[model samples]
Target: MQTLQAQIQIPPEFVLISKVEYEELLNNTLDGKFLSLKEVAEHIGCSTAYLKNEILYHPRYKEEIEKWCHFPTSSGDHYRFHAKSLYQFLDRESVKLFLKKKY
Candidate 1:
């Protein structure tokens, strides 16, 4: 058997998100609605592939998404998330920008 792993090159802008900013992004972006990946992509005006590649499937955000994205089950690359968690994961870059300006 052989294993292949593609190296994920994180952009220079990635940052560790604080709990408060994460919560705030959720509050601003979500409205207690549970949605599928496709729906979420629509809600945020992006392609589902973009969401998966940049946020969910990115190794840089794996730990954070595991903690906050609320994946209901572990099954391949297919996953679902509560709206808030999904937004938090998707909007983390924006949250980092917000934090940069706040302090």
Candidate 2:
């Protein structure tokens, strides 16, 4: 399995925050309002196919995402994810802490 480093394009804005502030933002987010798979792909600026196959479906990140956050659509096949949860998962512990400090 490949590391997240190989798949996602983390932005410079994210790189600039202190670890403490980041963690607070991640932990403080509310639990509702999710993003559909398509929305997530768009937010991450990646193709849906790429996100599904390489990031979501891939064995490594798949379990992590499923365990941390995921919701099945009404169809019960595709998954939807709470945007806040997804962000929390993607941002490192340090990043989350940094976000907290800013808020």
Candidate 3:
């Protein structure tokens, strides 16, 4: 058998994160009122794919789904959801039932 040794390299600039700071960073990162698809799924206690399939693509919810998203007409922008709108969509059937349509 042969013995081997390896060397590790560090960049010129590196900042160490403290436990408290790390926790704070995590909290801040996820604390926003608006969320992406992944964040919305996490909030609703479901997998992203499940949410996308079961709710996002459901025919009964099609018009409402489009209404709650952050981007409606932009071809290149990713979809985002306002926390309030998402909650309303789930909690209030009236919102979906009375679709006046949005421009």
Candidate 4:
């Protein structure tokens, strides 16, 4: 009996994400799935505090964020994110960045 081993190369930009995150992305491709603030933060790979401060509350992205997120209470402390819309928002931002760099 013989054993063989092979080596695989990963690209520099390739990211290694946990199984939970992978499943979250795979399973939440539809528009109706709602995610809590914490889950959105994790999916986007940012701290919850940073998500709230920079993206959620920032003036530049606030309007777009609001389109896909909801505040369930009058206090505006809790957020529920629409998974597909959130992903689309991120994709649009990335494309904007790419075009900015190309010009």
lDDT of each candidate versus the true structure: 0.65, 0.66, 0.69, 0.76
| lDDT string, candidate 4, 24-79, tens digits | 98866674888898897777666777777767787888887888799656776778
Task: Give the worst 10-residue stretch by lDDT in candidate 3.
Answer: 94-103
- TM-score attained by model 4: 0.57
User: Judged by lDDT against the true structure, how good is candidate 1?
Assistant: 0.65
Which of candidates 1 and 4 is the stronger one according to TM-score? 4
Off by over 4 Å in 3: 1-32, 71-77, 93-103
Q: Return the top candidate by TM-score.
A: 4
Q: What C-alpha lDDT, on a 0 to 100 scale, does residue 96 get in candidate 1?
A: 44
RMSD, one per candidate, in order: 20.6, 17.1, 12.2, 10.7
Model 2, range 75-94, lDDT digits (tens) per residue? Answer: 76767786776886666543
Give candidate 2 regions above 4 Å deviation.
Answer: 1-30, 68-77, 93-103
- Kindly indicate the candidate among 1 and 2 with the higher TM-score: 2
Worst 10-residue lDDT window for candidate 1 reads 94-103
**Cα lDDT for residue 78, model 1?**
50
For model 1, what is the error of residue 24's alpha carbon versus the real structure, in angstroms, after optimal superposition? 13
Q: Supply the global lDDT for candidate 2.
A: 0.66
Best by lDDT: 4
Task: Give the clash count for model 4.
Answer: 0
Per the 3 Å backbone cut-off, how many clashing residue pairs does candidate 3 have?
Answer: 0
Runs in model 1 deviating more than 4 A are 1-33, 70-78, 89-92, 95-103
Considering lDDT, which of the candidate structures 1 and 4 is the better prediction for this target? 4
